[model samples]
Target: MNFYKNNEMVPMTRRYPDLKDKVKKRDNKISIQLIRAWDVERDAEKVLKIFLQNIDKLSSYRYWELLRSVWIICGTVENAQFFSSLMKSNKPNRHYFSTPEEHEFLRSLPDQMDVYRACNSPQDGGISWTLDYDYACKYAKDFQKNMVLNNKINKSEVFAYINRNNESEILIL
Candidate 1:
């Protein structure tokens, strides 16, 4: 698993010094347990791997959580790239969203609309964005970032609409 440091991808152990030995020894199960204690820093790539490797072994809720965490914890561009690859062989299950409200929010979007994203700098190839401009601005404020990018896109380009906390986050291909 990798973590971003100064905008560069680095080994997860580098971000979590305690996991260094466990990761080096390939003790992922134990490492995972320890990592979870850190909460949001929860070894996301490893969780995704576990979900893919043991899909049938996990409970439906666990499956849903793991699937969602890819975008939640991983870099937005990385999450987009990963899902883009998956779309060739499989589409994300609607169950991965896990709430009728989330489905309803997606259904409510217009066919063509504006999307916004906040970042320290403008970037290309990002898929994760918000339908709410204020939501994007809030994210920018949280990080003290300056840029807010806006674009008009068709719903046909969207891979998913994730509105878990009313953030109106959308993923596009």
Candidate 2:
């Protein structure tokens, strides 16, 4: 029994070793261009175009980063609508927008402005699994309040969290 249990745990642990640690470290870094686009231009279309062009190249984690960046710039309501329309037009495979959690977060935002504020705030808790609606809303509100009191957005630290390793470099193209 001990041998079987140990073996079972090994594969699970090996599958994603130090993933959480990597994410925690990466969260603080943002690309200067990304910050400039959001802060200076504030052009949702330009940002969305970059995201759309490079959508296929993104890893799941990068996808969330793009979404969060969009939320930060466009805010929850507009970004949600933009994504909904994009999804309708593109019809990409399952890998692109795989999670129902993402869809729910977008669709339900109009009624949850406070949660949107929390989710977008740079100082708030970074993206986590929001599988449950009520929990997500409550968590976002708490995160927003905490961020409001303790932290402020820092633009220079922000790095574009996209995967440039892939052939499709959106900004370049």
Candidate lDDT (C-alpha), each? 0.59, 0.38
What would you estimate as the lDDT of candidate 1? 0.59
TM-score per candidate: 0.61, 0.30
The runs of at least 3 residues in candidate 2 whose Cα sits more than 4 Å from the true structure, single-residue gaps closed, are 1-33, 76-79, 84-173
For every candidate, C-alpha RMSD to the true structure in Å: 11.0, 16.7
lDDT of 2 by residue, 58-119 (tens): 54455554554554445443345554444344332323322343333344434322222225
Model 1, 37-113: lDDT tens digits are 33655565665565567555444333444455544655465356766564333433444533455555667878899
User: In model 2, which residue pairs have backbone atoms overlapping below 3 Å?
Assistant: 29-159, 30-158, 30-159, 31-158, 31-159, 31-160
Collision count for each candidate, in order:
0, 6
